[model samples]
Target: MKTVLIAGFNGSMGQQAVKLVNSMEGFAITAGLAHHLPDSDPTSYGLPASTQLFTSLNEIPAGIADIWLDFTVPTAVYANVKYALTHGYRPVVGTTGLTDDQEVELKKLTQDNHLGGLIASNFGMSAVLLMKFAQEAAKYFPDVEIIEMHHEDKKDAPSGTALNTAKLISKNRPAHQTAPDETESLAGSRGGDYEGIKLHAVRLPGYVAHEQVLFGGAGEALTIRQDSFDRKSFMSGVKVALEQVHTLDQLVVGLEQIL
Candidate 1:
């Protein structure tokens, strides 16, 4: 059985991971580290009684865990992942908002240590497919725009998913030389620019996670979209990373590799 330690197990996505781990065989949650627990117990989120819960990473036993599942926020993801890698523990990060420099450092650290780590902005399978589809469509399109929607509680706007999609599509863009705009329109109508692609971010209370990429050519448009209806939808991606962590000892930026 693979022993997994869940970091930030009290969060929304963390709770989902908790459910998924419990449902699977040949895997067990060794322990969980939550910044703080709810009034009741961790088992309220379906964590097994066999799983120990701690408030801080400092309390975790060294080398006991095969991997650390990070479902925490971006604000704390970097430090948590670093701690896991430094101690020879693999990490699967579902948190978004890690900076480019942080990612570079993360890959370097993982490679130097010969340890595996998986980080993805969105672990929903459709989300990965949407990214891939957008990238493919980019090869033929001249303009692209992205729209991402998430829960209001998500701190980062223009979610990592939208930005990453833009980056991917921009890489294969036509060489027609369209300058990335510097225009100020309707105050915030242009959204944020990732390379030459325009990105729009939306936050609402009822949304789980949703994104779409619109590619416009001379007279036609193609849109690829994906939605995570519930937190449980992310379980497949998490499970895939957990299943593949041993085989890949390098940092994987997305779920495309495992799929």
Candidate 2:
């Protein structure tokens, strides 16, 4: 059985991870880490009595788990993942807030330690396909813009998925201005820019997770969209990552790499 340690165990996504791990056959929840909480009793959090609970990274015992499932906040995710990598736990990260430089540094650490890990921006299969489809469409339709929507509680702007989509689109689309002389009547109205592509972020109470890629051609336009109606949609991809992460030679970014 693969023993799993879930970080951010009190958060919404973390609770979902707990359910997923419990429901899976070969995986077991060995421990949980949630720094924001004062209570360390596993039973108080509705976890199994046998599952160990920790309030901080320093308190987690080594060799307690084989996999580190992270759904922590943006501010804590980088440090959490770093600790997992160095301390012999393979990571399957879903928390998004890591900068480009931080990813580079973690990739090197994984290589040096000879550990396998994955950092996925979005685990929903539809979202992954949207990014893949967006990259392909960018070859034919270079003039494109992206809009991503999430819950109000999401911490980061221009979410990791949106940023990854932009990077993928940039690879196929040349760097050129979409509207050279266009001026906004109101300041910052056209959304954030990434290599000439406009990216708009929306956070609202009703939205789950959604994204749209709009492309304009000579006389026609194309729009590709994907939505996650429930957080459970992401668990399937997380299951795949857990089963296959140990096969990877080094840490990699994006679910597409594994897919």
Candidate 3:
């Protein structure tokens, strides 16, 4: 049985992880960190009473944890991920808003240290498939654009999902071509463009997570979309990462490699 230490073990995803481990026979939990959550919020989320609540990662005791599950905020990511590696622990990070440059540096650190780190922008299998499909289709429809939406409380604009999607799509395709427009009235009317491909971000209440890829062709158009209505949808992808962390000693950025 794999032993896990949860970083944001008081939140929605953390709670789900607890239940998954509790119901499953092959895994056991070592510790849980609930730094920023209210005392009562974690109860419904399935955090055990034996779990210790702390404001920092420094409080975690050494030599007992196998996997460090991070479901915390983006700002806390670098510090915690570093701590895990320094202490010879594996990490499965689901936090967003970390920069591309930061990711490159983390990958290097994971490689140099020979420690495993899994960082996923979106932990939904369908969303992963959407990215894969877009990447595959990019060769045929090189003029593809992306639109992403999420809950209003989410802090990041142009979420990691959209950025990663654009990056993947950009890798296999040439920059899309748009006809020159002589009309100029509203500045920023065309929305933010990545490598000549348009990207739109929407933030509103009552939306979980959604993304769509619009591919334009000569007199023909193709569209691909994926949506997650509830937080539980991400658990499957998280499970996959946790299962794979043991055999890896390198930084894995996407779930694509495991899939």
Candidate 4:
């Protein structure tokens, strides 16, 4: 059985990971780590009785778990991954916000340690396909924009999926989009720009995670959309990453790599 440790165990995604892992065979949650209630008992925080819990990676004992599944906040993700690597545990990170430089350093660290590490922006299978489709579409239609919607509780803007989509689309496109030289009465009406692709983010109570990539051409416009209506949509990808991570020699970014 693959022993797993879940960081950010109290968060929605972490709790969902616990449930999914327990439902499957050949895997066990060795322990959990959270960002809150450091002085109190972790068991009281609603976890499986067999799983131990801690408030920080510093408190986790070495060799207690093989893989650390992280769904923590952006500010803490780098520290969590570094600690996991230091403690000799492979990491499957779903938390975003690590810059390109940080990823380069983490890749080197994983290579030196000969450990499998994953940093994925989105874990839904449809989302992965959506990005692939967006990349393919960008070759034909260089004018594109992204609209990403998530729950209000989500801390990050533009969602990692949108960012990844923008990056992928920008990479495959042949030329920069034609600039619209129109004046805007609103300062932020055009949305954020990344490689000339406009990105818009929306946060609402009813949304889980959704992204729509709109591509414009001469006469026709194409829209590629993916919706993650439930948190469970991400668990299958997480399981896939967990199962395949140990075989990797270095850090891999994007779930598409493993898929």
By lDDT, the best candidate is 2
| lDDT for each residue of candidate 3 in 168-203, tens digit (9 for 90 to 100) | 988999656775664657876566778777888899
Per residue, candidate 1 scores C-alpha lDDT tens digits across 58-116 of: 88777777989998877888899988988888999998889989999999999888998
Clashing residue pairs in candidate 3, if any? none
Residues 1-259, candidate 4: write the lDDT tens digits.
8899998878889878878877768888889888685535545555567788787666899999999999999899999998888788999999988878888988888877889889999999999999999999898998889999999988887788899899998889998557778688998888888878889999899999999999888899999999999999999999899889889888999999987
Alpha-carbon TM-score of each model against the true structure? 0.93, 0.96, 0.90, 0.95
lDDT of each: 0.85, 0.92, 0.81, 0.88
Candidates 1 and 3 compared by lDDT, better number: 1
Q: Per-residue lDDT tens digits of candidate 2, residues 81-171?
A: 9999999999999999999899999999999989999999999999999999999999889999999999999999899899999999999
lDDT of 2 at 201: 97
- Counting clashing residue pairs in each candidate, in order, gives 0, 0, 0, 0
- Candidate 2 positional error at 255, Å: 1.1
- Candidate 1 has an lDDT of 0.85
RMSD of each: 1.8, 1.3, 2.3, 1.7
**Total backbone collisions, model 3:** 0
